[model samples]
Target chain A: MQKVMMGNHALSWGAKLSRAEVIAAYPITPQTEVVELLSNMCADGSLKAEFIKVESEHSAMAASMGAAAAGARTFTATSSQGLALMHEVLHWATGARLPIVMGNINRAMAPPWTIWTEQTDSIAQRDTGWIQIYTSSIQEIMDSVIQAYKVAEQVYLPVMVVLDSFVLSHTNENCDIPDQDKVDAYLPRFENAYRLNTDKPAAFGGLTGPDWYYELRYKIEKDTERSLDLFEETGKEFGEMFGREYGLVETYKLDDADTVLVASASIASTARPAIDQLREEGHKVGLVRIRVFRPFPSELLRKLLAGRKKVLVIDRNISFGMSGAFYAETKAALYNEKKAPPMWGYIAGLGGRDVPLNVIRDMIEQTIAEEHPEGDIVWIGVKR
Target chain B: MLEIRFHGRGGQGTVVASKVLAFAVAREGRFVQTFPEYGVERRGAPVVAFTRIDDQKIYIRSKIYEPDHLLVLDPTLIGAIDVTEGLKPGGWIIINSDKPAKDFPQFAGFKVATVDATSIAVKHRLGSAAAPIVNSAIMGAFAKITGFVGIEAVREAVHELSPVKKDENVEAAQEAYDTAEVPKEQS
Candidate 1:
């Protein structure tokens, strides 16, 4: 059915459609609505799932891990501070190899206290062994949630399907929700031999001696490395089922372009029109929307970004002391190439700051004008 | 594509009004997007929300800066914020005031319309007179003036969105649809 609803509702619908047996989540701004609706669904018996309204994000994640370890499909949602609170348990979920799916509404970290959108909160969790996928629209949010389960369960890694706080979470759009039976076919019930059973009790999360711990860590690293291909495969299968195609890195008019701008989350959606406008005016500009961040999709990016004369990276979050995190990662991805394009980084639209079309056009025009930019970090829309 | 901005106070259903418009447009098989500007969360604070409707899919996630139409749900919000600031040339502004169109502030380059939505809401008992919920009535006036969306769709949307006072909302919308008046110059 097609309904015009918020991106947060799309997350809840995705969980309910996937028949997630256990949902453990705490309320947080921009993320609270997703959990609240899921709680209502659980209460009304519209969805036959266990909704655990925990006190904090830590308890929420711990509960999800517990349910997943007990052979149940688990889900959760958090943003900003709540996500920071779950940082410790995030590693625990991945180490336990639990296929827990979480919707992380990315928000700027607080010192001045903001509930606005930013990407730092989720990007900061890069080393946690979880596969992260950023979405641009509410439809993509729903679709990605379902696909996350498929990819995560296959590789035994947790999946974080992320969107910008308020930008995507609060925005309402018409989304074509897939039928439950089709979703069931795309993502089957969880079935694995490695689970806790009361009849034949087994030990889990026990202390591992240093001799054995090294190999266990190696296996996790190896599995995470394997997820790059698995993510693409899952996206392909979802495309076949739902008629909406997805990929690790989605490109717009990048086939023969000399300049390409890179962005993720909601900003990528904003970049598309700017690219279109530039194209109409006979500029050889394109946009690359990075959907999959973890396992980085470095090979795919390397392939798409090859032969381009210039690359512009737009990051809504900063790494401080360094340039934008995405720019740093993109530069690293192309480090080994003999003659990589000069990638320029621009930071824009932090903490709910509005990004107009002119700012994006300015970024492209500035990149085209300079052989070497003025600085490593170009702050767009700043007062100076 | 048509861009719209809604100006109202918090707790006045400004956000919900945009959602209903987006939903109605989507139901008509056109693509639509609706969202509000996030700011300090406080009741009675001025709030701004936006909606965009297009025959093609919308890819721009930015706020509507050049709104083709502006709907002011609260007349008092006029001087409080720049309600008409980035309005496109020859755009339309629909105000919910009962005053005559000449009595309202004039925009040299824009068309204007007025609907006594507060009176409509109060007559139908949609909410108290002090805090009249004029979202549906204003939407009704929007539909009547612009003809961008059908009146039936607005009625259906209000019925679906309002948990209580369905009849009052429907009546309020119908009254606004009938009574909405365009500026003398434009007419």
Candidate 2:
């Protein structure tokens, strides 16, 4: 059954197929359609789930944390200011290791009331412990949602599946949605090593002494490191059952390429074709689409970019006065590697202005042409 | 290849028109892609939804900045956004308007087709003229204009999206199809 569905529809269907036990969302922009579909599914008895009408994004996260704490799979969604409103709770959800899944439809912040797509929303909240996965297509949106539940439950880390605001969130694609029974076989049940119940009756988040706190924090980091492999194993097992694979670093035409563009979200679709066009014109260009943004995948990224001549990162969100957000992450990922290519960051599409293929082509060609590639950042496609 | 761009407000079934058209066209064994481009997806924002129908896959992602056929649900968007932005030379435009096609010569390419879809929607008991959701009807017009899709296919697509108001929407679609006039093609 092939049908054109927007990213929002994909997210709803993804959550539905995951057999999400609880869903709480407040209507917002591109995100409204997703919650609408899920609510309709709940109302019509197709999804047999509890669709909570939360008053705000804050309450949405709170409800998800509650459901997750109760040992049931939970899901919620928000965008822009709504996501910002849940900023503090986002940290709490991840810190509590509730394994809640959320969809953040990327949207620009307000000053002049713009609802367009941008990466600022999610990128602003990157420091939180949640495993952030950005989607480039509706298919990925669906696939990632299911995988997100699996990964979050495995690692005890909440996951945020981020997609572009009106662009990817509302754009329709002929995505293949897996059957429910098959999805059930792949993602079975949520059995947490730490849970809330009368029998267990233990404090989930409690005060810690300064003496044991350092080691406990170190253990959390160590557990996160260990979960990286667990996440990969779960994704592979998911692919074996449902026939769609996912990973932290998804390489596209990077083999034997002299230059590669690192990006995420719907921009990957645009970059793929642009890379093909550049390659056809006898340019050695490719793309590295980051599926998993958290845990950074530094080692895998370093291994992949080892042989490439130059790597350019296109960050849709800026770190304000600093360089691009992912720009520093990628630099650190490749640092101390053997003969690594000079990496440059090109920030574009900050406010949902389209990141055109022509600009991608221009950036790659300019990077390839540069003798030194000396600048800290190369701002591509700027009028001024 | 017949590509139609629907121009309307956010809640006017503009995006669904593209989807239904694609679904109907897909039934006719043609490869199709339908999508909408709008900033906010809000209630009253001007939106552009496009459908590409051909024997091949659509690789062009850029806005139908130019369209071979135009379906304008809100005539006011005619002046707001260029209803004829990328309309092919001499392309036909089917608009829901009270005025005759001759009065909007400036907006139409060489050929203009007008239908009182709002009044039709009203007569069919669809809604008030203020928020006349002429999407299904306009999609029906799209079918008749190009004959790329049949009434049965449009009905099936409409059913997939919803079952309520099926009969009225089907009739509205059929009326638009029967009344829509095709203009001469450009070289």
lDDT against the true structure, each candidate: 0.88, 0.80
TM values, all candidates:
0.98, 0.89
In candidate 1, stretches whose alpha carbon ends up further than 4 angstroms from where it belongs are: A28-30, B182-187
Candidate 1, B26-64: lDDT as tens digits: 878899999999888687899899999999988888888
Looking at candidate 1 chain A, the ten consecutive residues that score lowest on lDDT are: A25-34
Candidate with the greatest DockQ versus the true structure: 1
Q: Which candidate number would show the highest TM-score if scored against the true structure?
A: 1
For residues B8-43, what per-residue lDDT tens digits would candidate 2 score against the true structure? 987788888888888877766667767777655688
- Judged by whole-model lDDT over C-alpha atoms, candidate 1 comes out at 0.88
